[model samples]
Target: MNYIQKGLLFRLPENNKDFSITTFLDGLKDSLSATLTHFHPLAARLVTLKQQKPPSLTVFLNPENSPGARFIHSVVNLTVADILTPTDVPSVVHESFFDLNKAVNYDGHELPLLSIKVTELIDGIFVGCSMNHMVADGTSFWHFFNSWSEMFKSRSFNISRPPILDRWILAGSDQIITLPFTHENQYINRPDHPMLRERIFHFSSESLSKLKTKANSECNTTKISTLQSLSALVWRCVTRARRIPADGNTSCSLSVSNRSRISPPISENYLGNMVQRLKATTTAGELLDHGVGWAALQLHELVVSHNDKAIKKLMDVWVKGSLLVNTSVHFDRNGVHIGSSPRFDMYGNEFGLGKALAVLSGYANKFDGKVMSYPGREGGGSIDLEVCLLPENMAAFEADEEFMSIVNV
Candidate 1:
């Protein structure tokens, strides 16, 4: 094998030979990035030294003592050619565990960079690889991707610097990070998704504007951004659409961007894991406190606050794992799980292939789904979103008027 003169290559081990597929995928995620598709090998940029050595287990608290640790995952070398796209050939179908197929989700011909295509090459047992945005943000991923191809095809190539995670989030000074979210403990029951799921939805700018208009009229609040209003409206609609008991309350999530909000302002952009939730409470009391507009306003305030102290407070507590954000949807006992935006834009990503036609994350019918909404190039006024929710909710949503107004669906 050729040496990656400048970049790094690491390896790790799986302590338990019986590591389940889920465990293997999750473990790979800690190391691999969702933006792996954007990166490639580079003799010069590559660090010839292995990244995982001794194949040992490594662990750390998530600042909140949130069972955070690193594990080693091993895989065999493999290659594929028939799998390449007509427009472009996939450099390596199995370059790493980050490329596993079973781990990825998408609705079209393109790939969800966040997923890895794990192939069971040998037996019912499988070796894994993955692709997650944070493993390599779009910018960094592309840099590495191009670099590798450049290295193999050319004599040498210069690679860009890797993305940093140090300042991704700065917890709120006033923020509290206590476990077993007592406040929302009851709403935290995990919904079972026995089957794997995938889904996609597209909206035009005009339709999105219509939805915004409806939200503005219904909530009597102009302070809301499209996302805030949309998220709020969606939460309510999803709950109603799915026939979920509204009396129990619900939580809609919105991931906040801390680009220039932090002290250091994580300036480098590649594949951003620089995302955290801005959860909205949908309980009647919460609605009364903020006038039912709580959800939409919560998002609007977070995005526009721009207060140094407020931003600092958020980041500080998050680092310490004491960031307390309770949403009505996650209002169950012990805190239900909810994830948001796998924020993709890094260094104005424009894959000579043209900005991705669409981007999304999360598994369908798997609890509340994760979403990613980014501006489309060529002046598509509508914001694009990707989601995964219960099938019943999805069907009901498709049949609702408010839902239609939210996205003009």
Candidate 2:
């Protein structure tokens, strides 16, 4: 199980006076209980199999073995308007929005794999979620959310396809084992920058189209995608903003989902970490000398290179404990990690009160060079980026001439 942590924050509008906090709390609690009834693995725990020959851990989903998901309710003094505004770009709301430390910093065994916190503000309510990456990936997590919301609104979980919880659908060598909770050497420490901050950047479809054209023109090829174009542009801006040395090695990595790429294709509903990181590396000078199109082509080629054979090889390396998954590794301000998908149904969580005012992330995303995207607030083909970087670099990035030319204000 990969011990990575992920979170989501949903903002609900002001409640009617008749709908008291107690009423809302009761609804949330009951809905969660109903949700667990279907997704029992979420309410379970990862117990160590001390006596097993392979020294493994398994998920125990019974009432006696699992204590259920953690639920928290609280009220904040801030109003929705104060935090959810254009001026609040690099939003500082995640830390105050939810307690991430309790989830990510847990000792895997003693804590619930899933936890939800409901914070009531002066004008609205926010729901923050923290789930262990070992148990669920983004798709599985959102699938659970869709089910929960369905149960909340329709009073039942009648979704067409339910989650398939078999961890080893593709049987491998006996020595191939799941990454354990004790193998905490996966993450690499970042620089001790005291003023790291996060900001949201919006790129309209038109803006993205213009960027795509510009990138293609630079490469003299029409092979790059909107995602590759945007990623290359951001990578350039961040590298330049940090003023890294010419010879310094700079890298950009994108998290690629392998569910569809595997040999026979893994079911979309099959729950596990079915994702890999695809990275492109270059020296600061090389990247700076090239146009956005050139950088985009590099990323495009990197993504295209991960064929079926490559994926299988990567999987083999993973099982052998030889895969150097440096997704969390920050290399001297020279690396940027891009994740999340614009295709994710972020704004669709209606929960019976209309769509969410704004969907957001938690403190886990506050690291430098972390970029995540979802559909824009106005919908359509627009993209909204939740970008995190050092405060100084962020200022330079926000003001970059080329970036400003295409970035939506």
Candidate 3:
């Protein structure tokens, strides 16, 4: 697992007004411990292998070594309606979540890999989880959350599915030259700038259908997917809003799950990071002049191009250390990252209360031009997008005519 931090906020409605805060917190802590018994790596520490070849680390587990997941209780005077007001949601939640400073690095054995902060609002409870990306990816992180929720709901030690902890499933290749390893090293210590901001945009199902229809019509084919259509539309809008040089190359890269792409499918229950980043590049001028269909076609081509051979080629590049640094690629240059599958079922986190009203990530503008789309909580065929951008670019992007036409504030 790479060094990454993923945050998820689950909004439990105020219908549970009778539930006491102390009882809620106690129940969550107990359920989390029970859940960790099954997913124990999260409670353990990483042991660095400084003398080993390929430079790796392994999770060291023991009864005494567990720095149990951190739990914090907070009270917010705002109502759930205020938190979901669209304009105020992003900055407000970002300021209220877990400690961003502690999330960056692992100090061998101190930092808990998983931490939960529950913010009690006048009308709801915000369950925020900060997970170390080094331990799991979004899929695995959610698996832990769902498992915890199951234990909370059923009060049972048995989980529906167990995660496979074999990190070496894809390891074991011949030694490679050290040169390729150096490419990712350059961007490892990159500095963080604080001028960036995060915001969410909603596109109703009707808007998504319109976008797909326009994209498909332009491409003279009906095969364009909703993701490709939306990615193309957003890529062009953000690129134009940024006002990059007309002839300069603008790129859109997607983080795709590689679970089923391998020769033999990896189980959805197979834990850890099983995603690969692939990209499509086009000149800014061409993108600006083209319709949604042209943009969709570029993305469509990028998706179809990633077969087994391409994945193997990517693995070869990664091992040789020539693959662009994953952290820097999505945030730097003229690149825009678009990810998240609508099928993730984020709205289903019931936890004995009613389903969540909304889901959000932790507050940091670590990356500009990054976007994550999720299914709407209301069960309409709608989509919710979480976007991070520089303050100026975000202002321009919010005012973008084409983008505004499709999104519902």
Task: Indicate which candidate wins on lDDT.
Answer: 3
Worst 10 residues of 2 by lDDT: 184-193
Model 2 alpha-carbon drift over 4 Å, by segment: 1-15, 50-64, 86-92, 169-171, 175-194, 322-332
* Cα shift from native, residue 25, model 3 (Å): 1.5
Each model's C-alpha lDDT?
0.39, 0.72, 0.73
lDDT for model 2 comes to 0.72
Reference-based TM-score, model 1: 0.51
- Please, what are the lDDT tens digits per residue for candidate 1 over residues 74-123? 44443222321222212232233333223212111132332323343222
TM-score of 2: 0.88
Residue 9 in model 2: shift from native, Å?
6.2
Question: How do the residues 81-150 of candidate 3 rate in per-residue lDDT, one tens digit apiece?
Answer: 7877757355667668554433443443567777787888776778887776656666777778788888
